[model samples]
Target chain A: MTGDVIASRDNPRIKRLRRLAHEGGAYRREGQVWVEGDHLCAAALAQGHRPEAVIVTPAGMHWVERWRREGGLAADVPVWTVTDAVMGHISPLESPPSVACLLPLAEGTSVRPDVPTVVLDRLQDPGNVGSILRSAAAFGFAQVIALRATAALWSPKVLRAGMGAHFGLHLVEGADAAAVEALRVPLIATSSHQGAWLHTARLPWPCAWLFGHEGQGVDLRWMARATTTVRIIQPGGQESLNVAAAAAICLHASAVSAFGGL
Target chain B: MTGDVIASRDNPRIKRLRRLAHEGGAYRREGQVWVEGDHLCAAALAQGHRPEAVIVTPAGMHWVERWRREGGLAADVPVWTVTDAVMGHISPLESPPSVACLLPLAEGTSVRPDVPTVVLDRLQDPGNVGSILRSAAAFGFAQVIALRATAALWSPKVLRAGMGAHFGLHLVEGADAAAVEALRVPLIATSSHQGAWLHTARLPWPCAWLFGHEGQGVDLRWMARATTTVRIIQPGGQESLNVAAAAAICLHASAVSAFGGL
Candidate 1:
């Protein structure tokens, strides 16, 4: 059943949702993330995540009810109605969504050595981080480890950029390089300079790919741990590729190589 | 010689620079774009762009002088020093750069029919537009045609996302689908559904790539003109890849195939 309307911006729960939307690290402290829009909510449900609560604007009530009828939303979950102005206050986007939900952050999982994983080392851009997650998920890398300085994976910007990939990923944030080193799979570092060409190289499948900060390449500690380094050849002579672009090219190459012979 | 320091944010030139930084279409109105940071400035110079003027903070004077000595800046171009606060006021970035330049926009060029080209069809994200530009430049696609509904190619955000690839590109914005249809090379449309897998397809070298809006895939009008449609396979079952990521993979694949036998 739906709960009472929360029309006030001053409501304590609304304030917390607003915080979660604006601050990346707030999710860590509050133990929940605010996922906006029906696409993301459906994705979370598809991934078997139970929303702690759903907040919808008056105009969105019909859509939420439709979702409930379609089994996209749980019948038992409480839905709170908020005024359009209150929805705007809680949204971080320029165009506020009609609906949003508070979902608990998945419990942190240890790196699984045998499974393919992606290690993000101090990536600062939320878009790049989220894009990489989507690429990783698309290419069969089921796990992602974000090193200490990486953007908060649950941040609203990242969630929006991730485009629902977050629901399917086993994301480990604020991880140490040491934790990554403990994984048994071979680590592959991507370099813009001084490595065998990726297209020509014999890449390792089920390996851990280490992507770094925008300005900095993979850290020395991570580089030292790399079983091999690969470079994407730029025949047209641009200095380097964008980090997210680089990740997709590398991941797709790996995926193709892995599946090409089968 | 360096001109007088601008300590006041109200200075006419500084106000214009701030406008150029914050507004997407300001470059079109003012006939100039502000390029911030040394990397972008150097890239512009390397591409034979003549800066109308150079603006730097007090601490950045030495670097500008060195650039001048090295011939990165033209001797006749006026150099103005601004206080750090004034510099901040002229920058849209969270961290302001010490140096920036007011460079005249390249005269609008018509889409060259013979050159390898990338067409933007109502793509709105500044970063995606920029990233695709970088991929185009890196893959030897020297011309980019942005359809009328696409994001402003010369905008500050797109320029920054482009990472200096703008200097090397022949970009035509506010273009129509008919202009793209007139290109001599085969038009390749990227689709998330119902197309040959990109990796397995025989991609044409120096063809035109049509990238579409983030939410709406390539328009049917453009799709109808396509000689072929290619899809990037996603073994991991995601619906689609980010447009930028898709561009990189497709471009890089074309590059490799073109150069592989040579």
Candidate 2:
């Protein structure tokens, strides 16, 4: 633990943190990504991922010390004490959390097609992806497969939105319709206007759920291959549901159909 | 109609348009708001609101003129032609649409709580509020009332997330629990871990649906006042549902229970 403080905003490490927070490729280049706040950090440690460096201000250092005393952090991890300005320079949030860390990406797990899954087709919004991931974790969907154009499941916005769900699921991005087609499980596709009304259908348990883009529904190729199409019956006077909201309803319904009351 | 060319970025009209697009307070200060893309402009016009200014690129002007020739925009409305930079500057979207407009906020109608309604409590994210609004509109919830701390319904992020649902339903922001109490209808509050199973319960239709903060559920005072507490039965192994997702399920379930099959 370097007690030497980084007071200058121009410090090379601070510059790297700024780039990592704001841009996509910085993390890949550095072989690490920055995670903000205590909860995410705790979640990472819980998942057995070790932090490379913990950067904090003096007051934040005290908070980190408390975290260590409380058994929230690994005793052996290195902590870097930095000035408040340096901490702010590295934080993605408007108000910096007590700590931020450089952690390696969670390694990809081998994906099995037969497991109940949630497939994202070019779901471009990071927040939507994150919310869907949270729903997937909540409903016990075994995996999340994002089409090539979908937002990165581990991107900063998605990570923030997912809360800690990213640490709990099998997330595979840059996938295609072929991947979904290969799954042996029944595939359920959602639409604003189509297929079976979700509530009335004999929804099968442990089935794959397919959600699509904000403006566009499931991709045409996947739609063609989908065994059945389901629509959440909207009795209201409006048009369609947000894809993420729809995913939550569909996932919850599937979970209940599979396992009973929540 | 003056055919004055506005090529310079420093033009007052252009600067004002940029400000209106970027600043949250711009609309309130100027008594005007910007609507970009054909869909939103069409939605506004359909609601009988006229725009103060219409800025379009040369190509956009040509396309709009063709549409007008084919009986698109109302004939009496004035449309201003502009350069691409001006059009881009006034647009909130990353890829600016061909047309952009500064329109007055439409006068809101009185809240009619006779039908299904959705109430938001201290929802701070503009995107979530917008998505919830879209869900409320789709599920036949007649009105959406946002707590004073809820993101402003008319904020740019919300306006975009909501698509055109803002025009389709009655939206009132800065509301309180008293407003929910005043509905004179049964308030169905959504809970993650308590209450009767949503499906089996004799849920009320056309009822008032209540959702709380992103991190917290409904305020305890509001929860205690709720006529019924209901939860979506999830069988899988997750802690809680995202607030927006929870709202969609509850609202849809209410619609189903009251109206019969979705």
Candidate 3:
């Protein structure tokens, strides 16, 4: 059934939605995050995370009503129609989508690391996290371990950056360095300072590709245990690469070395 | 000289800074954008784009005052010391920086035809734009051209993602297909559907690398004019790559092929 359309900015539910959409810790505090646009909404639904409520702009009301008629949103679930201005006020993106839904955090499943893995160390940027996830999915990394201090994997910004790839992967956040050390495969670290040139280096198959913090790079402690540290030879003048770019190249090389058979 | 610490949110200058930070067009309308944190502020000074005014948090004021005494900010520039909460109101990043400065737009420059270049077609995300800029800078690409639909290169989000590479590269935006054709160089196109595998393909040196839309890819019209079309062999499960990831690969491949001294 439809809840009354909310036009007022001060509506408690609307305010809560705004907080969940804009602020950082809302996901942890509320145990929910806003999923926007039709594709991401569909992705969440397909994954069986039912919407607590569906919010739509005036132009989007026809579809929302049709969804109700088709028994798409649960009978008990509420649908709130908001004005475009209010929608923009709550959107994390530049252009607010016509529809944004409230979806519960999908519980983290046991990470069964069957294929090659990626270990992120203190990677700070959400965009980097998202890009890494997309690359990891593309290259068929079995799991992504987000070490403590790395950006939250499920944050709205990261979700948008990942472009629905998050739904398909096994991602663990706040993973300790020791936990990464415990993985079954060899940990191949990437650094600019010391390592064999990646192109000529013989990369091991089915190894864990270790990528470190954006500024600091891989911690020295982990470097001590690295099975091998590889470097992308830079002939150009720039000193180093953006960490996410490095991750993509390293992971792709790993995929290539494995004959991309996994 | 320092101004009365701006205590009210409705102060005209504060409102203007907030607008510039959040709204993209504010830069064009007001001829300025809010550049936050020490690095960007330092970069602006280095590039000779002096700040019109600065607002610093109490903690920020200490270092900023020292910088001002050391001739960091322009002599005539006004400094407004404020609380961290006030700075947070105008910051685009998750955490508010210690200082925020409003800087005017840099003068425009044309893309020189005879240089290794990168062309972005309809790449909509800002972070991707920033990453591509970083890649372009790293791989010795002389210029970066963004199609009209691509995210603005100097937009705060893009600048932040670029980590100051924007200032280092010649960036041109609002480009058209015809304009891209105007550049008299061998255009190398990247595609997943049809092309020689990039690794084995003979790529021309000092060429322009053209990467197309994320979903649709380089337009057919552009592809027809491509001197060579190269594809990355993805032996894994994915159908295609993230455009930025593909761009990095193609650009790096081009660099290697061009300059590897075969």
Candidate 4:
């Protein structure tokens, strides 16, 4: 399934790839997400996903061959070789990776009602959204629901920040309060003030933790749905914690309670 | 101490302030740091630090007067009123803040020997550095030491990311491993692999935790100095945790242990 080498940066496939890399919402329109670097590609493959197409530099051709031999890539996957200049044109990073792939967005999955979950309410930073996803996956939160105003879950920057956590979890983006309300588990909202101290509180093991926007916290509509609200105590008295840091602390607390001492 | 309104962007003071906003190391050369927003300015004043000068938009003049009335700003501090155009020229944010101030970089402080501390080993992201500082301060890590290779501690981005955490902690930047070695308490290194599980370990109350670069773990040189190494158990099996997320978990664990259930 090898294609003719795309020498021109303006090739249709190359232009689409560039759009996918640069536009946060392109995946929603194109039906595929672009992922760069070997680690992400390998992670997708390890999760039983086959790339629709792979773009590689001439120098990366050997690495792709190694992947096929090692069972990290499929032989039938379309492979396109490109010049350094073309690769640069499609890259979103300052230092471009050696290879990249287009993975079809997994069809939207319904949120499982009883499993541990994380609900992101209008989180704007790609880094924060991705970091929360990573923590959710690491701490046994099997599903992530991102509200409509949140940064696009499949954006390249979020993918890089997630560091391969995307493939392992059920990620539902453009979700609304109704989707969150449908969950059977207790909804826990994190606040910097106006709740029980996190450490002393008995966090529900299989619960949905709601983290909100950088400045305005959980939306008032969603806050009305939360069964419990907890605040990470700031003993030193800074106004608030970074949302990603707060998510990590809250998720780890639940993990600790469930696993019983690490 | 009010200066005549400076209407030109080419003014030397305005040019220097713009450089301080854009350049990471400009504070080191300019002998001052730039802070925007009411929260950070109020935090600095609460810490008993005086501003050398306060720059405000015409609309912000009334706010500055209120600050003076409330004693958040000294009556004698130089105040420069700039038009909206000049304010935009000096601002790094897309939405320019109404006001900003110049605070002298306090002379570098030495890491206190026996207090809870955080040693940053070449961590490059300003957001990560600032978030870590917020966590350290919240969890009772009274001091932070950044290795020479780390991001500039007083840089505008770091200052913004810190969210007023900078004023609350003793920060030492451009420090060498020698500075870390002088700490009398046991040094702890956090790794994704190879050590006791962080939750189960009896963490030292006043220990120093070494966090490293985004891609690189702590440098091998400092690993030799670690009295204990701990790993946060990842139940879902992601390869590693984000540095700031890891720091929050580790610091919170130590805080819980020391403070006896916050």
Candidate 5:
């Protein structure tokens, strides 16, 4: 389904793409998430996610072949050749990318219990949220639950930071405490002040790591449900680490401990 | 040395403060580094750094008393009270902070060999550089060397990402490959492919973990000089982890393996 070159900025399809690129919550309304660049598109395809459409510049048509070589970039998927200006109109990045794809957002997503998980509790920064997602995906945490107060999971900033981890993850956005409580795995809440040191703690496998807001630790009400509290040892006597860094260390610990080093 | 209320934005001292806050390279020219908020001020004080001047808003006077309670804030340090408008004029932050301090930048700093250290080789992102700095400090890597191609180490963005780790570090910025070669310890270069898995390696106690540019990775010349090349085992089958996350995982491995779980 090859679409003709779309040059007009006011095209209905272009307007929708603009909203998805700029607005953080637009994907929920549009039912499609826009992923820019080839790496992300390849990653999504690798996870068996077929894009609804692929948008590219005339010069960027080379990427179509590259994407096709990487995964099943289906022949039937709509390929919209657009002008360079139109590419910029639909891109949130400073230097507009050559290719991008619109993938249908999954509906009715639910948490998978008894699996490695990472939960974001009212975490603010998009960079922090996204970085944690990469760590989770890298360390075998297939499910990520973002509490209602957390940054929008599909936002452009977060998607970029996640770097294609989104496709491989079972992400439950806008989840509440009730939904989190439904998880069968033990909840391991991370604390900066008091908790079992991560290095020495006997970390449980298939557990959910609950990371909290930047300013405040885990909510007291949420903290009450935790099976154990863990803290990373700052041997340098510094106060604490950035949340993403802490998440990486903790998640890696579980991966190495439970499965042994690869 | 209590300076009286100065409300004018055009004041010579105010202009210098504005430059330091806004321009990333201004600290080098002015020979002073401006730090904002009580948290950073306390961190500097904890490291026995006496600010040349402490600028505060009229209502922000409470911070001066609070900072004085923290490690040796000093009696003779200049505490300059300014109008709220003047505070806004000098601040680089979105919401103007109540207190900021100007500390003299160190001169003629050199590398310390035979210590747990991190080497940033031409890393582009400020957030990545700063995050690495935090991980290095947290894991007891007391020395950090930023190659000439790396991001400006003392920039405001890097400073914010670093949290308060700058005070605890022996930072050597703007160094060439020659300077890095002078280091006595083993040079541990990190790679995404073709390296020993980090978990199984017998990591040295006081080696330099050389991290490279986010996109290009470690330079070939630098890699050639590496005593050992290490890579983190990504259990989830993801292509790779982010550079900062990789650094955190690698640094923590050295920390825990050598110290035996702190």
Candidate 6:
């Protein structure tokens, strides 16, 4: 089906797109997220999702055209081709991408207690949180429990940083202490100081790793509750690594210890 | 000594600071970089660096006052108090930080051929470059060689993401292929595909790890020159990991292999 040409910025769909693109939390209210670029949109389709609607600029029409030719999109899904002005008005990026799709936010769900998990405790930076989610998925951590005050899991910045990893993992946002406590797996906390060295530690498999705020570490309560804590030895005497870097190292170590060298 | 209060943003020193804050390569032109926040300032001092001058807003005066009282900063290093308006005008941050220091950029230096090093092959993002620097320091990599197209090492964004890692590492920027090949140690390239698994590789000590662009893998010329190529095992079957995350994982693996668990 041919996409409808939307020339005016005042179009209702364009206004809605603007909100979802600029306001990170607008998705929560509208129950839909705007996924831009082909990599993300394709990832969504690979996961068997049908976009509620598609928005394309002239630059993005080629991808939509190809997908339609390939019968990759359903006939019922609306595709709107907007003018550059309309796209620029709706886009948060300086150089707005050519195409984007609106995907419904998955319904709220409880944490899966048995899988390998990473708990984000009040991580404020969307980039850091999204990178952690990407690392978590790569290293076999299946779930992410983001505590209250953490950057919203589905925010545009987070989604962009995640690079489509969001489509692959189970994420629980705005989780409280009780939700974390309910996990059956051991809670392992990572600290830059005061723990058994990561490579030397006897890491448990199928555990949940708790990484805390960018500056402050895991909450003291979580630290006290942890079954074990691991420290990544900083041989150069730097005080700490970036939180996402720390998570990648720690998660990789756990994956190696449990499943042997990748 | 009491600080001179500069109330106007048009002051010459304030103008210089605004340039450094807003332009990533302004440091190269000005021969100095602006270090912001108490954490970064303290990190510099801890490394025995004395700022050429200090700029403080009212919000930042208390620390400067405490430092002067404690005899931490030198008598000759001028501290200028600026109005909040002046600070806001110079600062790129939404809520401008209370204080920043001007440090002279060190003269260009060549890489130490035999030390563990990281070769950034045109990675574009300042955050990625800075995060890799932080990881390099944490994992015992003593030197970082950023290729010609990579983000500048002393850029404000990189400095912020580095979180003081720049002070501890030997950084050589704008390097070419000749500079990279001059290193005496092995060139170890990391790829998401077509390499020995990282965990099982016989990781050589004091090797130079090549991490490439965010969108592309290492330039094929460099890839073919690598003594050994290693890939991180991604059990989740994800196509690729973020460049910085990959760097942290690869560098940490090398550190662990070279030095027994810390």
- Top DockQ model: 6
Shift of residue A67 alpha carbon in model 5, Å: 3.1
lDDT of 2 by residue, A90-150 (tens): 7767888777778876555445778889889899888898889888988888789888888
Q: DockQ (C-alpha) of model 2?
A: 0.67
Residue-by-residue lDDT tens digits, candidate 6, B128-153: 89899999988899999988898899
For model 1, how does the per-residue alpha-carbon lDDT over A140-256 read when each residue is reduced to its tens digit? 888899999899999999999999998888888889856786788888998777788888888888888999999987889889889999988787785578899999999998888
Rank candidates by lDDT, best first: 4, 1, 6, 5, 2, 3
Q: Judged by DockQ cut-offs, is candidate 6 incorrect, acceptable, medium or high?
A: medium
What tier of docking accuracy does candidate 4 attain?
medium
Candidate 1, pairs of clashing residues: none
Give per-residue CA lDDT, model 3, range A126-239, as digits (tens).
Answer: 878888887887777768887888888878888877777676667777787557756878889987777886766788867888888888888888788799988775655643
Off by over 4 Å in 6: A1-3, A68-72, B1-3, B65-72
lDDT per residue for candidate 5 within A1-262, as digits (tens), equals 4558899999999999999999998999999999988788878887899899999988889989876775568777889989999999999789998899999999999878767889888999888898999999988888999998899999888999899899899999899877788899988988778888787888888899988888786788888899999877677775677788888888988888777733
lDDT tens per residue, model 2, B30-52: 77787777777666665566677
Please write out the lDDT profile of model 5 over residues B50-110, one tens digit for every residue. 8998999978888888777754678778888889899999988988888989999998888
Residues A44-117 of candidate 4 have per-residue lDDT tens digits of 88888899988898878877998899897888898999988899999978888889899999886777788999
Task: For model 5, report DockQ.
Answer: 0.65
iRMS, candidate 2, in Å: value is: 1.6
lDDT of 1 at B205: 82
| DockQ of each model vs. true complex | 0.69, 0.67, 0.33, 0.63, 0.65, 0.73
- The residue-level lDDT of candidate 6 at A82 comes to 84
Cα distance off (Å), candidate 6, residue B103: 0.8
User: Predicted candidate 5: what Cα RMSD to the true structure?
Assistant: 2.1
Docking class of 1: medium
Worst 10 residues of 6 chain A by lDDT: A1-10
Point out the worst 10-residue segment of candidate 3 chain B by lDDT: B232-241
Predict model 1's lDDT versus the native.
0.87
